[model samples]
Target: MNNNIKTILITGGAGFIGSNLCEHFLNKGFNVRVLDNFATGHRHNIAPFNNNHNFQLLEGDIRNLKNCHQAVEGVDYVLHQAALGSVPRSINDPITTNDVNVSGFLNMLVASRDAKVKRFVYAASSSTYGDSESLPKVEDVIGKPLSPYAITKYVNELYADIFSKTYGLETIGLRYFNVFGRKQDPTGAYAAVIPKFVIQLMKHESPVINGTGDYSRDFTYIDNVIQMNELAMTTSNQKALNTVYNTAVGDRTNLNELLNYLKEFLAEYDANIGNVEIIHGPNRAGDIPHSLASINKAKILLGYKPTHKIREGLREAVSWYWSNLK
Candidate 1:
């Protein structure tokens, strides 16, 4: 391992973010391995990388200690992005969410520590700011978790901090705020807003906007997420080494605004989608009203700069849906 070309492991490398991470590291001439059970992830996401010489896939579940142990061997860095996402999904079955999000995360931390990985970068969530009515959410000031999923993501940060202090393991947490981009699955019941809306409009079906359509989010693009992971992995500052960073552009887009943007953007692909009127649904349980992230720390500390805002990201996403879904 030439240090920079050292082998790294991405836990959910078959899912949208994980697969993109794998592709990114591979392009940078790194040796990458993926451990995924294909539970919520799809094999097709990694299909394009199957022929790449620097890539390997181990079909295993993270819920099993043995599998997590096997994946960590000789891994220089671990990007732990595997988790059961969705606030409503967690509310519906918190036990399963805890099993994967919390317990499974512990397993990975221990395994990575034993394997002597250089850095452990994991996915944290913006939901951890639940009910904290602060604008431009920061990393330190957080409120009570409003959902089971929020609790799990908050726990990830807590455990990562503890691991750094007691166990001498290096950790960095990226608090993703509504990430969406290419290869993000759109068929799942708990599918995220962007993909769900894109697919719905593509099919001439009305996309449901939850609530009065005023809830806003800092919709981050996958490329920006990749930038955050790469920066976190390479940061040298002592303060930046063991902390969490908000991985988003400092902006927000409301659901109704999102609907109009989607319709306008998608019309360039299919003229029919230009006219689809989205229906409003009742407010979802465990759902937060507004979400926005302040990326100043990530910029000043990690030298992290996000390339895509909501509109630019959505344009790319809409193009992907138009071609892939059709």
Candidate 2:
């Protein structure tokens, strides 16, 4: 094991983003501990790290205070990524979403405070932007939440702020845009757009767009998300703490453009994928028409510079899906 000062605790470490964090931190030679209940996370995601001596797993839920305490034991940094995602899922089951996203988040915050960890970094959401018609979303300016999921995420920021001021718990909230890449699950009702489209195209089925495909998003890559987390966890700038920053590519891609990119990339593996048709559907209930992030805060505060643009990220992500799912 490589010598490192920090023992990182990544909650929801079996999920796509959390699992990627585990892989990255483990590779960096930090002692890594994972806390996951396997609710939405897959065992296969963390299966590779089982053999690493520096890796430890605490099968537990953040919803339980005792489990949160146990998970934070001896951990230096808390990358709190555990939460029930999906706006539609939250819409259908607001009660469960509140239980996990809000209550569960509070439990982790309390545990991390008691444990006195160096930092508590968490996954916030761009959905917090809600009905706001801003071109590039800034952290401080947000509109009323449109869904239960957005409410939960916004509440998380409030709780984190209170924790920082009241308990002196160092915290940073990463408001992620449409983050997509390898390890993102394509199966399930609430699967993200990129992976879902990739799977559909690979199967020679027409991928459906949520609206007329004019709605846009700042489609952030997973590596950029990881970079923000690392900087948020390790940065020396005190001004960067206890606040949220947009973790995104500072660029937007409409649904039509996104579909075209997916087809263009996936067709490299299967020629017929390029010819697949796209179907349009009704706009989702909790969705906004556009989302783009202003990553200026992250750039100035944490020195964050995204390594991958939309096409670069899509090409790489498509390659991964082709290699693993094919």
Candidate 3:
């Protein structure tokens, strides 16, 4: 198989991050196949790629081992992005999140092992840091997960580790920190900040600010996330394999700063829209006060470098949401 182009199976490829992955790989000349049930992922996300000869879409759920088997069968690598993702959503129904994020993850790992794929790269979350107050989160040190969603992602790292040792499966996990950008669904209650803010502002509606707006995050962009996934999947370095790396720009932006930033970006679209207000609400359950990532390891090992910071990212995100949603 040519190293530059190989068949890649990306789970949840119709979802926000997954769809981005599909587009990225197809652009790079790789044969891309997607496994998604369209539960949370929308068909419109992948509509642009439907006619591409290099892209193949499979209508299946990761919960089904048969689907996992088929998806893993002719792939050189596996980018396992499928999961039930949101802390609040997990709080509302822990069992369903656990079933999909945990159980379904296992199904993908097992199937990938059986297929003898080159590498298994999956999405891990910064939520894994949980209550850890460390300014810049290091990969080795971690605190107990505060939410079921965090627990699921942390478990993915654990399973990836165990699988590497026990089953000799090569795995790498990318711990995403507040990733946001194009194709993010703002309609969902569990939608991430950037998209939700963009949509609400576009509709001349008030955006909710959970807590005192002091809560901060190392908001990552989608393009950076795609670079991380690709680097993890293609790395040949022994030290880079069988571990997790923090995928972020290593900069922190508080909710207040982010809100103002979004508003400023939106006002460029319509000056009158600048008056949109923010409603303060109580802090959410299982939310960490601050989040920042230490990306020293990923940079050294995988040659991973994040290209976009919050401002540059929000510009792209806000513009896409405006053009696409409105």
**Runs of candidate 1 exceeding 4 Å displacement:** 1-4
**What is candidate 3's lDDT per residue for 88-148, written digit by digit as tens?**
9999999999999999999999999999988999999999998888779999989999999
**Model 3: CA > 4 A from native:** 1-5
lDDT of 1 by residue, 43-105 (tens): 999999888888899998788999999999989899999999999899899999999999999
lDDT of 2 by residue, 1-326 (tens): 33455799999999999999999999988999999999999999999999999999999988899999999988899999999999999999999999999999999999999999999999999999998897889988899999999999999999999999999999999999999999999999999989999999999999989889999999988999999999999999999898999999999999999999999888888889999999999888989999999999999999999999999999999999999999
The candidate that wins on lDDT is 2
- Provide the TM-score for each candidate, comma-separated: 0.98, 0.98, 0.97
Better of 2 and 3 by lDDT: 2
Among all candidates shown, the one with the greatest TM-score: 2
Compared with the true structure, model 1 gives a TM-score of 0.98
- All models: lDDT? 0.92, 0.94, 0.91
Better of 2 and 3 by TM-score: 2
Q: After superposition, how far is residue 15 of candidate 3 from its true place, in Å?
A: 0.4
| lDDT at 135, model 1 | 89
Model 1 scores worst on lDDT over the 10 consecutive residues at 1-10
